[model samples]
Target chain A: MTLLPGRIATVFGGRRWRSLAPLAVLIVLCILIAIANPNFIELRNLVRLANSAAVPLTLAMGLTFIILMGSIDLSVEGTLSVSAMVVVLLAANDSNGNDYGWWAVLAAIASGTIMGLISGLVQTTLRIPSFMATLGMWFIGLGLSVYMLGGSAIRLNDASIRDLALHRFLGLPLAVWVAIGAFLLAAVIQYYTRLGRHILAIGGDEDVTKLSGVNVTRVRITAFALAGFFFGISGVLAAAQLGQSHAVIGDGRLFAAVTAVVVGGTALTGGEGGVVNTLIGVLIVTVLANGMILLGISPYVQQTVQGLMIIAAVALSLDRVRLRIVK
Target chain B: MNETFSIRRIFEGKWTQGAIPLILLVGLLLIIEIAAPGFMTGETLALLFANTAVLFILATGVTFAILLGGIDLSIQAVASLASVMLAQLLPSLGFAAFPVAILSGLVFGILSGIVHVKLRVPSFVATLATGGVVTGLALWVSNGRAITIEEGGREKTAWINATIAGLPMVVLISAVIGIASFLALRYTRFGRQAIAVGAGEPAAWAAGINVDRTKIIAFAASGMLAAIAGVVLAARLSSGSPVLANQLLLPAIAAVIVGGTAITGGLGGVARTAVGALIISIVRIGMTFVGVNIFLENMVFGAVLIAAVAITIDRSKIAVIK
Candidate 1:
């Protein structure tokens, strides 16, 4: 009996260790890069790393919420792209003659939120799987963005938004602070609210949650809506960062955000992991990417490495016993 | 009473999961024929058949994976990698390297199967991981550049490009594979075991079936088929690129689903998937010929996918779609 308890303790410890594996890998990678290139330790480079990770962090936070509900949102890329394009086109000096101003930002975010809500409704009411529903949304968003932009990139001349992305305060860019704020907000909503608990319960067991009188559909729709808000904010930030917007702004964010969420110990099957894990995941990914750059790794090699990391992270985090069949 | 019972049995048999694809195919053809008078011309028909061939081949390969209740997202990546490998080895290894490249794809597929079966990871996550790795390999091997087969390579590609009595060779290959898969599923023990596993793994296991090995082989077979599709696609295109098969991922899955293959697993076969692929091809070609706006094309595709899935997915088999 003592032996069994000891073995159980060992297994528990092993799980905990695996959960922290990505963090350890990130720390080691950072140290190695610092040793290889002294410039990697510089404050400016660190800030740049933070800024680069901000968009992905925001997207990942939203994705975490969806994944926690045992659903996925593949529409993030499309929503982000469309929103980014909207921001640029509306705020473009030529397109709108610079008249939209701050309202453009608001409109851009609203567009994303609305798109999310629509996807949510389609999924909940039509009984379409979130995967397929969001995939449809992705196509719609991609098509609309392409049509609106006409394959042309729009330059943003909005001074305030530009400052928000480019200017630094408290030794960090505004985008980084925004990402941090989003992370904090996500944390609060996930832990402090009935909605968060309901979301988790839905993921744990949808039928049971419904039996408990939780408005399962409403919670799910709200989760998707929240994800859209984050995606919208991230898209606007991306436009501000580049000082331009193109349909490709959301091109690679999907994989990156999902990877971050997975790396942060979130279950893809949902009902576990949270914003704090995402924050760490975001840090690990950003640091790895920045470290690779600092170490002068080839872009192609970096892609392979990053992809491998994603696979390894997910493989490590997934609780296989819980799943009878994986689709 | 006997006659009526016999008639009902015939109706049920005829409707066995294959009706959806058949109807979709007929519907699409009718729409296209009405929309354009000469839509059935030899050239147009040939092109449509050719386009459907590769997709059909891919869907057939993916059918085995789906039959076992596991989805294979790695088909696109595997195909891409195989194509790149074929291009790289064509000069030195010539035709001899064809088998080698395909074998490499099989190896990757087996690895994916092991990862899923042994590691107990979900098929989606496992395939996603391996897909990323395969894509990375493709990118690394090709350096993101398109590789043409060169002069001598053109001869081999020509055979693939040439038609067998006015039908594309690719279509013939797809037909052969389709027939073989259909027969295998209908008669072979392997096919029955796959269906049994998908229908109820615990029951299958209790019946003393080696469920893990069956699934592994199913995935491996899927990989092999995807490789064949990739090689055929390369032969037709006359070049291999890292991104060649990126667009096929969703379409392949869509074809399988639209063919009445339950997404929850089991209860479909290769013949239905072939029809599904044909339906998708006709839709794509018809949309293009009808001058639908390119932007609206994607929306149309999505709509069609949703409609097909809604109509064909066996709701009773799926408790909840997460």
Candidate 2:
């Protein structure tokens, strides 16, 4: 009887090959939701869900790097808010005369990178824990967004940018294409780039990586910067979809990203998951959210459900034996 | 280095680590007094204390959670829920509504404790999830609007506003709680066990402490205090809304860390959080007095929060951030 338990552990725990668990969970959830509400399976609704997932997926893809490093960034919503405001004000808009064209997107992404760079610098130089440093950064970003917003939302008037939502490619919104492009780029970076592998190595064993002559400080900073760039892209995309830049542009998206990252089975303790898992996690979340709405659930209840999923995901992925302390 | 003659030697010694925030407090008072002379009058101080009293209580509670190498983000959410419940029950329950609100807080705290200890969920994530559920429940109870005390029910909550011997009742109540908590922390087994757990759970476990029970108690205390803060906040504002206390979370956490308590747990007291709360109030109102733009407050607050943690955290104790 004891051997049965030991054999089961060997199959699941020792193999280190449970990479597809989150995807399996997504498929099961989709089928269950479809049975509960047939409208969930409709092609039109699925397309809409894809469109909605694009923003969160982008945010999650950025967040994946940080989580893979065994740290967290609570500054997502704040970074999103600031970036969206900047893009709206800089683009061909009513609030400002500066229409820098595509450069506006680059500027916004650059701004996010700067914000992220500050967060990373703070983390490495001051040795402040990522949780506190990122939290403080979140506040700064939020404050800057509110300051720049000045009580009025600027409407994006450019056809090229606005067409991101109106434009469709392969039966999916242009936003989805952008998000998919982001995921592909992130995957390439994760697999092909030295910085990408370093992040996973640091998460897996920082001391060992450091002893191996890796520039841990520079790698950490670049990882955070990359994540920030993605956040900037996510925010700009959200603005494009909404056609307006408001202070609350990223008000409720932080949890969705964190939820997706964690739910994808990426260990909070660092090193076990990758961007591919995050893709499945984001899909699961997006589908669950859309399915709930179709079933006539209230938004308040939906928030609670999402919260529960976050906790459940964390609990399931927790390696209790490996955990020394939880803070 | 002149051992005894140098000012840095005397002022920045290890013995004075806990006193750093207090020293900074004095420096800030001087600045505020010089820059905003009319802002720190006796009446203004009382009002400031009144405004900060609830947060002071909440921070004091969170100090316990932080001491255990964990955090409780649900403080504001529990308080918000308690605020709504207090408003709902004020007419039928009268002043008795206070204990009920606190009880609800304790229940929520225990709920988070159960999740953290029993389910092995980390404290921050566990509390955050509970906070969402609490927020949703508060929204349902309030119907997405602020609930006010009834026509004549204001008289019942008036005690929260009343002054006793030139001190605001709110401040006085918080002081009483603060003093009691300080004594508990200084002299009680419960308090010491919590610190041990925070400093090193493995060591505490080896030393025969029930680490799990201590964590539960610590979380419950945080929840209870958060509830009390919410009830008092509703009384002060004359209304309770679902989102009323949400903004207090970061400030409360900041206050605890600013008091020289380590975010990684251990090495600070509950009383320091009360002093930390006072410092926060001065900085906030003082910034307003100095003609700073309202939009920049959050940025300044964020900077100050980071600076405070940087100053207070003992890097020697932490080998790696993760």
Candidate 3:
């Protein structure tokens, strides 16, 4: 039994093969859907698939770092909601006379960063677990968003900003392009920065990383901060796409983003995946949702499938031999 | 100086453990009374206990999981699922639906435990995923709508609202469960093993304690109790919906931590949870009484949760807080 577990761990433990499996699943899913419905591969459907994926992709990109370091951020939905409201109210909205355009978007992003920074501070300085801190942060964000919304939705009045969701370039919406840009930036950080490498090291083993003279606290905080920044961008894109904002706009995105990250083969225990994995994971999740609708499956079943996917993904990617205790 | 120093010493004494929540509860009551006179009426008191009973039950069940250095985020979702299932089962099963609802909780708890222990996923993530599945199940079963108990079914649960010696049955049931949980934790071998495991798993294993069994039992207890709470909620509301008990997760968690039970595990009990639940209930009702915006309620719970965890967490037990 011991030998069997270890062997399975090794097979799934290898980074190259681990990433490949998700890619293979994504391709298989696409082909199967195309076969089932010839229109699944049509440019419009594909564009729809990509459009649905953009927000989740951005959210997952931020979560990738946190998961990479073996921490979680349950505050994504909350952060997105708060930012969505912030961006809407600031950028020409029906509720307010303000029309700051791109500057409002920047302010909204800053709000997300501030929330992320506080979460980071709470996690590191207070010694609270990231889950608890972020969970608390989630409520705080929702409360703030709801307070701002004052019991109604805010419609975007800026045609230029709303066009981000309506206009398509290279057959993809501007929102999709923005998500791609965020992914590229994240990849650059992951593959070519000290912060990214240190995150991996910390996740591998915090004590060793600390003993090796790395500033573990700073790195962890930065990872969360970066995640918050991405959440901000996602909030902006989501609001832009819907052409309106409310406290509930960010709902269902957290599960989607986390699901994508895990489905892409990034270990929840940390140190085993990157944004590259998340990109594919986003596609997989999006394709699954899109295909579910195309095939006339209930959206309710989608949640069950995603929930099971997380458990199976985490179970399979788990590196048993490396840790003495599972908890 | 001598008297104050001795009082401080008494506060720090091991015998004084679990007293802080009680003290906080008293302090909050005093504030509420001052802010709104006649708030201490028997009717108002009854209302307070009624509100607290469901939360107390949830915290009681969750206390077992927390006592074992784990958490069951799925409890609230399980409770919702139980309520949804009970709503559907009540008409056909009459009063028999209660057990079936509670049993489903037990099964889910065991499944969560298995996933956490055998499958080796962390309890948080495992419970989270399971919670999501339970939520989906609830939505699917309820057709994403509230399921009202028919008039016939309502008669079956009417006893839940009946007064026993001037106390609501719901409040009495929660008290019984609370006392039972406290005794079980204090007297049972399994309870001792749970504490041992949470105190330190490796040492517990070395001591020949069935560590995995203890962990699984903790989660099972959590699930079952959450279901019981759900049943009571459905009884009170006369309906079950996918969203029933959706807002209770944070408060229940806050109740557990605020009761002086250490979030890191093995340092608290159901007695403490009872006190904690009272404190949380008062604070919630107190917020409404104070005219705080309903939207800010979640924010307050969030803040209180962070503050409570910070204060009660045993930093010594956790070398690394992930």
Candidate 4:
């Protein structure tokens, strides 16, 4: 009996070989794809992968907070899109000659943060489920973005703002550096802060957290606000990279970010997983996407494979004993 | 005497919950009728019924998944795949392909269920993952092209589109499915088990319910019904495009939630959801008829959904918002 218990402890301690399964698969895929095309190992490809991973990584880090609280935020895509559009509309050297400079970026971030706050308030004060509340934000954001942009893609020509994506730092783009910094900040807050512990407690057991005087509502609202900040940053980065911004930029980020969070060994049921896991998750997803493109796989097939991989990752990481019903 | 009085009160409370969506539906219709006199015309009404048919069907199917406190986000992707398959195989397999297409959807949905239950993943993630796979499959099968039925197939398409006794065939089908689902939820053991599981998983488990299996079955049923909806939609449109059903996701979920179903699981039924779908369809159609700016309309719709959920969700039961 002691031996069985010991084995279980070892497995749960994150020291066992099984904990590395997702990492192993990721490494193997990278190796196999690199072998298939030696160019995949080139510095340019690696840099490209890092750059591409930047936005999703930031978004995933934001989602990690909400997921850790055993809730979800589906509004990231809409918020990101709206922010991106705002960045382009305000700063882009368009035919209208509107050049608000760096202020545009500030405005974009503020919009995203405000949207997040509203969603958090609705969920916490109004007692709406996070899923429904965030979804409502999604529609509102999408509609508002479209209304603001008027179905036109705006080109960003502001050199200072665009430098974030185009400039290289430590042999990788500045965007990647920003993503790394964001990741570190998130990790710190998640592990070291009182709010972080409270979030985990909430996810683990809401009543228990409330009983412990955790101020559950405030913590959740803060998490969402932080999530919105990350989304705003991601939107700016996205616009910088593409040199243009449109309302549709947010279309696919939600799935990609959620996928990364899941791949990073974060439990969808929440109260577990962290920024480090999300970093790995982001790398895995970005690598998979990059590998598929490098291997010349059709975009359609890439989507299918990505979908399959998401399912497989969740299946491998999910803890069945804890959940009574999954919805 | 007290027992009888309490029973009557219980019945009345249930009716009140059921009445909200009905009232909203009538209210919207009345507003639309006043705003646009032509909105209630036979042709306009027929078109609205036809347009809502697919939504109603999909909503009904999703109601089952929602009933078990799980959501099937894969319905849109499944519908997309089913639509593509039906259209692509029509010439070779003719009408026989419809069942095959729907069956594929059911299989995919069951796969999602198995993964959710057996792997112990949350239904949200499980369905989300499967939804991605289904979307990928749809894209792959369609080769990124819309598959249109052959030119001469109009006769069959029209036949399928034709109304029975002045009711659109799609609406009639939706009605039949809704009635069947209503009965299953109200009368069957499976339905009771689902409600029990949703109400409190631990309690249901203690009561000897196979909670996982019930939830899985509910998802499977949802998938099958979504496929049926997809087939109907494909027949109506006479084409299958991989991207066509993508927009359906929000509306279907919105309809389910607005219908008084709890997002946190338990305490909703098919009848309530059907009423919810009707309300949604009318609101959307009515808004269009009134010529509300498309963008503002979306915002309003989303706001309404959130407001409805805020009003309808039972706060006492859910101790924490998350």
Candidate 5:
């Protein structure tokens, strides 16, 4: 007999209907979690959950486009760390004699953009695999971050910026607001932009996209650059929330972001998911973590669960017909 | 077109790939000796070998997977797990702990292989996920703390630090493994199958090669070797932690690529990886002598890695770089 998941897959086999699977999973998770702990559905806990999901939401938004292009970016942590360090050092911080304020935020995003652009160049111009180029870029970003920090954590003295994390608007923090804004912007781009279409096309079939007269190189680079831009925003948000930044502020984020993107129904092989799916994915991951804590499960087991979730999700969503050999 | 053809020929030339690294190794040693007068002494050489032993072993293990045109990102995590296993088991199992620890790595490697082969997940992603699980297991088993080998267990590991004919026992062990790997890759049916599969999977399959078995075995060997490196590391450090081999991943990968083995696969060997590992060690030591800041070293490695992959990657083999 077909398993429950298989039966669901058969029923919702339409291309458009596939996106509903993650949504269904998210809803079921919330229900199950609410049953486990009656307090889980409370407004305060959810607001906190939304607040926690801000950075990951931002991270996964950018990653969605990249993975949609069938290219992986392992440089999220590096990009995030570099941008975070940039914002901290350039803003009104204890480590440096600078108070560029909002300009610091602009500069942080620009730094992330430039790093992303470099990764794109390395991937397209140099013809290195996206993963390897980004992996190296991750190190470069980390080293750049460490070099900028000069071996110390820099506290953000700018209350205006730190307030982004602390202050609430409509019961949701400004960080979550910023994340929501990013999400909306990403959704618009995914649906309305020509670049978005190109990304999906490339992920679907690069050769076909190229043969159809699309500038595959430019599209790929732009996708990476756009992802980098998001990473920059998330970096600033992360630092603002923490009130301090270090070289490792981006550590642990890459895995979480990747896991969320994959679990959100965006196949690593690309072309099947988008930012909307990632939003659901971000909530699922955030809610799952919160539920685990509420159920008194050991924190360490969370990582194992995330890893297994990635394997299972990828396996379920995998397009086995298109691949004869996997390497 | 003619110039491009010639360039490709030179790069694809097996001897050129191996020769470049050897030249770089010699040139680097010469530069270091000139800069720091006594850096080339036999004592320093032995120290260099000793220092490079673990990295070499780790790199060599990963070479098997790379040779198959896949990668094992879990090596470092597996290595860390193995170290933790060895340290914890040594207290009770003594010498038997080494094998048990190694066996754990083998099992994990097989799991990675199964995930990649059976599930059709990409090697890197499969290994990444497995690495995460292994890291969690390592943390859980060690209780997220360092485990120091007690006096009784210390004696079991002491021989790792011992010298045999002026070479550290660790270095000797790595060399033997390296040589064995070279032989296995050169003379054995498994080695030839690995090469065939890596060269072209469809072609190998058409030629009746068991491509799946080769890939799995390659990953398994990679895992086992990584575990062996972990055991040696625990012996030398007298302790184990979940993060013991954390920093070695990039260096090990760098060693494999820099030794002139093409990341695209089927062009390099275990011997080339040995040269590559030594090259990495020398470059790191050379950076120390040049007084490059420790933090900036990673940046240099990143730059060097990009340059190496750019030079060594076989563009002709891959129609689409992604």
Candidate 6:
């Protein structure tokens, strides 16, 4: 657990070498890809990589809090779809005459927050596991969006909405900047806030956290709440970027977000790792997918590869002695 | 003394295992009768039994995994893969296609089990990963399209759509599977071992049980049943579809959990899960009968599912929920 023998970087708990492992692996992956295809290092491709990572990065950052608390949220796709549909329907769109402008953005975020609150309440008050609560909420969200949309896609045409995701600033896509800003916000929350520290403590030892005069339930609710807000924001951005919205808008993003969290050296057992690690995880996933696409790899094969990587990452990051049985 | 007494009570209370779902199912039926009086006819009951068959088969296998305190998210994916394989193999193998598809499912389940055991990875993640791979294989095999059984070949699979003595042949098949599984789980050494491992893994291992073998075998059983369900599903549709097979996964898992089998493991069986599946199908049908919004139905199902898990969960056995 020493600071790597005075190397200046505080490699916290260097005993397991986990803190540096994902980063090292990510670097190796980048180098290998760069060698295999030098075009991978090109600025245009790299920017596109960052742009793609933006939505997922926000999702991972939000989810990092929940995972830190040792709970899971499988409702991301459901909430994402609901929020996406909400924003599209509220904004100046083809499906409806209503045009709430920026207020629609607030509405979208509110929808996600509400879903998170329901998930949190179900877990804490009902004493149901987070997995099932969130899963149920996922179906609820999916059903809500599907029902509301009535099986139709709505195209958003708001200028402000387009600017939120599509506009470029400082030679970078707006989506990328939004993602970086989200990461910074999450970092501040993780390191400086009482709620964030409490989530980590609860994950580490729930009984100890409860005994120390901490409101475990409230902290958990807050974690899910913030995560929901971010999921909503990501959904809005994703829909805006695409200019079309439907119930399936966030179809496959949950796995990618979860993979980023676990691959970033965060123990699925909880209470280990931070946003910086997640950023590295997100980068690794983004780069790998981008590289595979550049190499003309088939989508089906890429799915298999990602699935394998998920297995490897989870197996490697899990602390065996601490976690004897995994359900 | 109190802890030991409670544990013994949980083990012996067969009535408690399915009591809640039974009450819920009865109440739901009554409500359905009152709301839509004509809907309780023999035809409606037949349709209910028919639709319940697929999920009942899926949940039967999931009950094994739940008894072992693990889960198999790969069930639906394995079923999907089996469907595609059955579709492709039928032209060549005809009647043998069913066994071949079932074997593929068993192999897929065993593969996931081996990974989970050897790597000590969580079954949740391991099954999910394997499910992803299976999904890919399905799309690849079917070339991402539905494969319809054509012409006279359809007649070979017609039993799937046939009715016997007023009930669909599918319902009869599920009943047979259910009866066999119920007997095996209640009377066999493997079944007892599954309960022990789920009730307390550390204690089971200490008491000289082959915990790993029991878990892996249970998972494999789950896969086999799910594959059978897929075969029947494909037959009923007269076509095999990768996507359609996946749609049944969540409902099946919900049925198993809602059936009063603890997610923490042990204390329920296939019979209980059968009740759970029946409850789900009834609720779905009853909602439609009452003119309930299908969207609201999803929300209500989610809420009810949460309540079901909350009521059935063995909190004392589990220290945390992830």
Best by lDDT: 5
Residues A185-234, candidate 4: write the lDDT tens digits: 99889889888888888888888888888888899899899899889889
Best by TM-score: 5
lDDT of 1 by residue, A1-327 (tens): 123323443476757776676677678878888999989989889888888998999999888999888888888888998889888878755565655888989999999998899888878876767877787788778778877777677788988888878788898989989989998999899999999899888888888999999988899889899999999999999999988887677766776787788778787778877788888888887887787777776555554565566666666666665765555
Question: What C-alpha lDDT values do all the predictions have?
Answer: 0.80, 0.85, 0.88, 0.81, 0.89, 0.83
Which 10-residue span in candidate 5 chain A carries the lowest summed lDDT? Answer: A1-10
Model 4, B1-322: lDDT tens digits are: 5676674354336557677777777888888888777777888877777777788788888888877777787899899999899888888886678789899888988998887777666677678778878887888899989999777554556766887888788878887888998998889999999888888878999999988788778888888888888888888889988877877877888888778887656878887787787788887766766687676655776787788777667676665668
**Which pairs clash (backbone N, Cα, C closer than 3 Å) in model 6?**
none
Model 1: lDDT to the true structure: 0.80
What CA RMSD would you report for each candidate?
4.4, 3.0, 2.7, 4.2, 2.1, 4.6
Please provide the root mean square deviation of candidate 6 (C-alpha atoms, Å).
4.6
Q: Point out where model 2 deviates above 4 Å.
A: A1-18, B1-12, B36-41, B91-97
Q: Tens digit of lDDT per residue, candidate 5, span B168-287? A: 898899989999999999999999999988888889999999888888899999999999999999999999888899878888998999998887888898988999999999989878
lDDT minimum window of 10 residues, candidate 6 chain A: A1-10
What CAPRI grade goes to candidate 5?
Answer: medium
Candidate 6 on B1-322: residue-level lDDT in tens? 5675785476436576568677877888888888778767999888988999989999898889878888888898888888888888888888899899999899888878876876677787788777877877787778778998776658778888899888899999999999999988889998888899999999988999988888889889988998999898888877887776666767888898777888878878887888899898988876776688776666777766677677777778877555
By DockQ, the better pick of 5 and 6 is: 5
**Candidate 1: docking tier:** acceptable
TM-score list, all predictions: 0.91, 0.93, 0.95, 0.91, 0.96, 0.92
Query: Please, what are the lDDT tens digits per residue for candidate 3 over residues A3-85?
Result: 44446756665556666988999999999988888889998998998898899999999999999999999999999998899
Query: Cα lDDT for residue B156, model 1?
Result: 64
Better of 2 and 3 by TM-score: 3
Deviation from truth (RMSD, Å), model 4: 4.2
Each model's DockQ score: 0.41, 0.57, 0.67, 0.57, 0.67, 0.48
Better of 3 and 4 by lDDT: 3
